[model samples]
Target: MNTFCLEVSGPFACFTRPEMKVERVSYDVITPSAARSVFEAILWKPQIRWRITRIEVLNPIRWINLRRNEVGAVVSTRNVQQAMNAGSGYLGLDIEDERQQRAGLFLRDAAYRLHAELALSPKANDPLVKYAEMFSRRATKGQCVNQPYLGCREFAADFRLVAASAAERPAIDETRDLGWMLHDLDFTYPCAPQPRFFRAEMKNGVILVPDFETGEVKS
Candidate 1:
C-alpha cells in the first residue's frame, strides 16, 4: 500500500465530544476521522479513500476555555424541502430568537503529524502513482479543495506534505490514556448512521490508529 504523510498545525482545535451535548468538550488529541479529513482536503476522489494510520503529537496537550454565541437551531430539513417544492416555509435560522452562549474547551497551539494510506475502491481506474504524485504536487503548492479545519470550520489548519521518512516524531514521552474516542461515523446504512468509537492511548506523543475494518470499534 502506498502511504503519505502531512504535517498540520493550528492555533486552536476542538474535536468536540459527541457525548457532551450541552458544553463543547474536545478530545485530548485529534481523532482518526479528523486526520483523514485533513488528507481529503488536500486530495480526494470518489474512487479513493484516505485511511489514517497514526498521529504524532508534536505539541504538548493544552486546553483553553472560550465562550461564543451560537444559534440554537438548524434549518429544518422538512422546511427546506417545502421551500424547494412550493416556495413556502421558513428556511433560515433566526439567530436573534435562538441565540445561545455556549462554552467550548479547545486545544491551544496544537500541532500534529498525520500518516495515512490510500485505499483504491473497485471503481478506481488510475494508477496509485498518478494519485500520489497529484497529491504531492498540490500539497507543495498549498492547494486544497477547501480550507482544512481543526474539527471546526472556524479554526483553519496549516498543512504541508512531507516525506514519510522525514516526518517528525512525537515530542512528548508520557503515556496517557485518552479513553474512548470517536473513530468515525458509518454511513453504509444511510438512514441509520452508526457512530463508532475506539480506545485511545497516547504513548510517547504518538497515537497509533488501528484499521477501520479489524479495529475493535464499539457502536
Candidate 2:
C-alpha cells in the first residue's frame, strides 16, 4: 500500500455533529471523512480512492462561539428543474427575507496531521506509479483542484506534504473517548445515501481510523 502524510491547519473548523440539527456543533477533532475530503481536494479520480488511516491532533482542542447569518430556506429543486425545462418562474433564493442568525461552536486554532493510503480500482490505468506520483507532485506544489477547508468553506485549510520522520508530535497527551463519530458516507447506492459511524478515541493525540468495510461501523 502506498501511504502519505499531510499537515493541515486552519483558524476555525466545524465538523458538525449530525445529531445537532439546529445549531452547529463541531467534533473535538477532525473526522475521518473530513480528512479524506482534504486528500480528495488535492487529488482525486474515479479510479483512485483515498482511505484515511489515522489523524494526529497537532494542537490542543479549543472551542469558540460564533454567530453567523444564514438563509433558512433552499431554492426548490422542483423550481430549478421547471426553470431549466420551461425557462420560467423564480429559481433564486432571497437572502434578505429568509436570512436567520444562528450560533455555532467551532474549533479554534485547529491543526491536524493526516495519514492515508491510496487504493486503485479496476478502472485505473497504471495502478502503482501513475496516480501516486501525481498526488505527491500536486501536494508539494500546493496544487488543489479546489481550496481545501476544515469543515466550512469560509475557514480555509493550509496543506503541505510532510515526511513521516519529520512529522510534528501531537500536543495532547491524555486519553479520552470522543464517543461515536461519523466515519464516512456510503454512496454505493446513490439513490439512498447511508451514514456510517464508529466509536472515536484519542490516545496521545492520535485517532486511529478503522477500515471502512470491516471496522465496527454502524449505519
Candidate 3:
C-alpha cells in the first residue's frame, strides 16, 4: 500500500451525528470520511482515492455548546431545473425568511494524527509512489485545492505532513467507547445523502477506522 500520514488540528469541530435530526451533536473523534477530506483538500485525483486506517488524538477531547444561525430552507436542484425550464433564469432564497437557530455540541481545541493509504483506480497508469510523493510535497509546501475544514467549513482545520521522527510520538493517554458513529456516506447520486455507521472505540487515544468495503459499516 502507498501510505502516508498527516497531523491535523483545529480550534473547533462538529462531526454531526446522523441520529440528531434537530440539533447537531459531534462524534467523540473525527470520522474516516472527514479524515479523507483533509487529504483530498491537499491533493485529489480521479485515479486515486484515500482510505483512512487509523486516527490518533493528540489532545484531550473537550466539549462545548453553541447556537449557530442557519437557513432552514435551501434552493434544491429541482428548483433550479424548474426555473431553467420556465426560462425565468433566476432563483433566490431569502435567508432572512428562512433563517433558524440551532444548537450544536462540538469539540474544542481538537487535534488528531491521520494515517491513510491510497488505492489507485484501474485507469491509473503511474506508480503509487508518484502520487504519494505528490501529496507529500504538496502538504509540505502548504498547497491545497481548498482550505480543509475539521467538520464544518466555519471550523477550519490546519494540516501538514508529519516528520518521520515526530510522527512516532504517542497520542494522548486516554481510552473510551464512542459508540456507533457515522462511518461514511454512500452517495446514490452526486453527493446525495446515504449514511453508514460503525462501532467506535478509542484505545490509548487511537481510533481504528474500517475500510469502506468492510461489513463493519451498517446502513
Candidate 4:
C-alpha cells in the first residue's frame, strides 16, 4: 500500500467537541474525521476510502475566542419535501429571526502533517496504482473538487503534497494524553450518525491512529 503525505494548515480550526451543547469548543488537534474529509476534498471516489495512519503536529497549539451570529434552527425536512412536491414551498430560514450570538473557542495558526492510505472498497476493481497516480497528479497541481475547510466550512484549509524526502519534517516535542477523542462517525444510518472514539495520546507531537475498523490499538 502506498502512503500519501500531506501538509494542511489554516488560520482557524474548530473540530467541535461533542460534549459541548451550544458554544463551539475545539479539540487540541484536528480530528481524524476532519483529516479524512480534507483528503476527500482533494480527491474522492466511491471505490476507495481514506484511512489516516498518523498525524504530526508541527505548530504549537494555540487558541483564540470569537463571537459570531448564526442561525439556530435548520429548515425541517418536511418543509423541504413539501417544497419539492408543491414546486414551491417554504424552504428558507429567516436568518434575521433565527440569528443567535454564539462563542467559539478555536485553534489559531494551526499546521499538521497527515499520512494516510487508501482502503479499497468492495466495489473497487481498479489497481491501487491507478488511484495513487490520480491523487499525485491532483495534489501536485492543487486541484480539488471543492474548497477544503479546516473544520467548519468558513475556515478554509491550504494543502500540498509533500515529497518523501521532505516528509521528514520534525514534530514539536510534547506529550499528553488527550483523553478519548472522536475518531470519526459511523454513518451506517444516513439520518442518525453514531460517534466513535479511541484513547488519544500525543507523544512527541505525533498522534498515532489505530485501525478504526478492527479496534486494535497500534503499539
lDDT of 1 at 23: 96
Provide the overall lDDT of each model, using Cα atoms, as 2-decimal numbers: 0.88, 0.91, 0.89, 0.90
Ranking by lDDT: 2, 4, 3, 1
Q: TM-score, each model?
A: 0.94, 0.95, 0.92, 0.95
Global Cα lDDT for candidate 4: 0.90
Best by lDDT: 2
Number of colliding residue pairs in model 3? 0
Quote model 4's TM-score. 0.95
Candidate 3 ranges with C-alpha deviation above 4 Å:
86-88, 165-168, 187-193
RMSD of each: 1.6, 1.4, 1.9, 2.2
Candidate 2 weakest lDDT stretch, 10 residues: 163-172
Residues 170-197, candidate 1, lDDT per residue (tens digit)? 4577789999999988988999999899
lDDT tens digits by residue: candidate 2, 12-78: 9999999998999999999999999999999999899899998889888999999999899998888
**Candidate 3 clashing pairs, residues 3+ apart or interchain:** none
Among all windows of ten consecutive residues in candidate 1, which has the lowest summed lDDT? 163-172
After superposition on all CA atoms, how large is the RMSD of candidate 4?
A: 2.2
Can you write out model 4's per-residue Cα lDDT over 1-219, one digit (the tens) per residue? 468989999999999999999999999999999999999999899988899999999999999999999899998988899889989976788899999999999999999999999877889999888998899899999999898888999999999998872647699899999988989888879799888898899999999998778674321
